[model samples]
Target: MLGLSAFLESGRGDKLSSPVKQFIQNLLKANMEGPYGSEWPAEEKVKRREMVAPEARYVFVRIASLGEFLTTSEREKTAASCVEERGPIVGFVHFRFVIEEELPVLYVYELQLEPRVQGKGLGKFLMQLIELIACKNHMGAVVLTVQKANSAAMNFYLYKMRYVTSTISPSRVDPLIGIEKSYEILCKTFSNEAKAILEEPLELVHSV
Candidate 1:
């Protein structure tokens, strides 16, 4: 289990361990820094908090351990359905949010798939599910950061659901590795649709 140690290890519990945290830390750093420079301690800590808050309603996908899965985290369980094929847990999606603008900005915090189930359209399905949750929550919009280099994922965010691009600053700790290293932000809005729907509601109801 050379590469699978983190995924296979027991006692993962609710929060990510230091090593797991470090792995995510470095992964995000590389993604942000373009395999070039390093991040400072303060910057690293801020990144870690943003990614793996223990209180955040994180999601995990697994193939086994159905009975006791919900008890393994600090956050409250929202949706915990299984994806079965021929009958077993093949994948799952976890979602949560941080408050923004007095509304919950839905975050598709974690998505995972077993190697055996990777190629199917499950990812797209899960994303749509998250989007519906965002709509239901009446969020100002949904936000998630993706590496600029990941074209496949960027396409999914951009074309599939119509996420618009924006940018954020590069803190001193993790200086922008290059132009592409700027944080990529995406959002969706409902104000236009809301105005249209609200205006027609009384007229439509009366006509009906």
Candidate 2:
């Protein structure tokens, strides 16, 4: 069942509620520890907390009785009390609309699903919904960063979703220079303006 209608949107003003933060932390630990633990354990902990901070917007998947999804907006709401008795949250997507390199974009910070829900097309469904949101808001593109060690995510974004490596991605800018970073930037452009801006050579754009 699970259609696009079963998602709720919430905005965290200056801090994440305890319950929401805990949910994110648990998901992050389950999803990222394997890829990031060996190299920078402490850093991963810091990053996980930072990712779910006040500034991020969230979309939570809710299951309905009839097997269809429901969509709700809590833009004016605050605190975890709103979610106290909303049943189990199957998964969530954290993102923000921001301007990157002067180009407007929808940047996805995290897309974590319960282990039992993985590989059921829910991830792809959520991403498609995000793209729709971006387009409606006039964002030129959608972008996200993936850890190099997370092969599954990399494959999902690149091969399955057809996202391309951003021209500004460290590796794309300069392979040798980018080796120091452990992540790759990926993007999907929606307009010619976005393509021109994001696909331009970084060196050329920087010089201009």
On TM-score, the candidate that comes out on top is: 2
Candidate 2 Cα outliers beyond 4 Å, as residue runs: 1-7, 13-15, 64-84, 201-208
lDDT of 1 by residue, 1-208 (tens): 1111111122222465554444445444544444223434556567556566554554333333333323455112212222223223334444566664444567554454543344455566667767777788786556676555666667877897677652221221234543546346555655654323222233553586
lDDT of 2 by residue, 104-203 (tens): 8999988887654577688998899899999999999999999999999999999988898898799878889889888999999999989877776456
Per-model lDDT:
0.48, 0.75
RMSD of each: 12.6, 7.0
lDDT of 2 at 183: 92
